[model samples]
Target: MTTRSDPVPRTVPPGMADGSSGGTVPARRRRRQGGERSMVWLYVSTLVLGIGLWWLASALGDNALAPTPMEVVAAFGEGVRDGWLLDHTLASLGRVLVGFVLGVALAILAGFLMGWYRLGRGLLEPWVQFFRTVPPLALIPLVIVFLGIGESAKVFVIFLAAFLSCVIATFQGVRNVDLTYLNAARVLGAKDGTIFLRVVIPASMPYIFVGMRVALGSAWATLVAAELLAAPTGLGRMMQAAQQFLQTDRIVVGILMIGALGFLMDRLLLVAERRLTSWQEVR
Candidate 1:
């Protein structure tokens, strides 16, 4: 048997045919590496410039008020060797951890309820608004009176910071959930709990993450302020002591360490968020 046959040739786009677009993946990856290197160089250059300025000033005026960069670095080394820096660092971070977890847990629970249930919002939002507007420092006197200048006071202040920020975030995240998906879930006869757990919670995670990050910054700042007023030991306590002694090198070292540690903590949160939401589509 014989059959008629027709043949057609198809052409693929030029760059795509070679499994590479205008820029091959390897080339783009190289460009990305170059950019990262440039950024690293820029950061290093700025740090060097700052150190140079400080060094030049110290050499010329023989100033005692401001320590040179090298002096601060040396002080940091000494503090580490003496266990003073490490102990204080751990204490401060521990306070933040306990406080932050308590606050975040409460906020997440309350925020979800408030966002989902109208009655909960009506009941709690007024108080939330009132506290949100008030400065954490202003409440120090009251907190001291109630809880004293102990671990409780420090943790209490940090918890308040984390709570207010997280609640706001949770409320907004719930409100911002896609209405269409919610409706579809409802149409499918999904229970309120199921819809919330499956759809709304997942949808609002990005915003929740954003809020958590902001709250962490607030937690650190608030804890430092609380400790500055009165703490047996911590970074803030050490910093206050340094100020009294006019140990400019130790002060500078403490400040730099705080900033570095805070930076690291934020990066850790970011890593957790990325791992938790690996299945999520980027918005």
Candidate 2:
């Protein structure tokens, strides 16, 4: 038999044998680094441009109605120095956190039941649909009457907002799981519990996360409106108090603070989704 010289060794590059691919690894790393840097710059540029536009708008409008960015910054600093801002921020944040957690937990349970069981869907969906149509803010008066104008009242309104948004999304998510997957698992001799835990839950997780994000937004929106219910200390209360004296800068600070907090929370949720769902396909 003719001895065949090892073709693989000849064809493979010197560095590729060791997985470096003749320095392509470093080049790819550099490109990735460059892309990350570009993203950072793009984000910074957009933020700066927005601030510039806001500054221009303030300069062109009545200062009383539209305070300058500098004025807003000064107000923010003063609030921080007085420590009242921190208190209000914490109070508002606490209510949102509590309401969001409760809403999401109950929503996931109810949604899973409704999506998986015919009787649960028939019994619960009509109520869910009815309440979802009614805005959470509209229920504030009833909530206050029953729960009193206390923390529970505010949290209840926020809970409604979060629950309605989340339950619907989660319900759809669970319902949308591909039947083929279920059949395949069944054919492979997987039991109902195994299929549910291994297939249904993982498949529905994306939808759950999406619902959570929506619920978080709803919770924040409801928080401001909820805090309007005789709250002694909250960003929403602070804004309302400032509005009486036309303190536009303070109002702007509250708006900015809410936006910042919401953005940060959303980003955190996104990071969690990415880490947990790394195996899922993405566009």
Q: Name the best candidate (by lDDT).
A: 2
lDDT of 2 by residue, 79-140 (tens): 99999899999999999999999999999999999998999999999999999999989888
- Which residue pairs of candidate 2 clash? none
Model 2, residue 183: distance off in Å is 1.1
Which ten residues in a row are the worst by lDDT in model 2? 6-15
Candidate 1 deviant stretches above 4 angstroms: 1-62, 279-283
lDDT of 1 by residue, 1-283 (tens): 9775876676666556657776465566588679979988998999889878878988888666878777888998999999999988899989989998999989988888889999999998899999999988899999999998789989999999999989999999998898999999999999989999999998888888888888888898887798965798888888899999999888888788778888888888888888778667543
RMSD of 1: 4.6
For residue 192, model 2's alpha carbon misses the true position, in angstroms, by 1.0
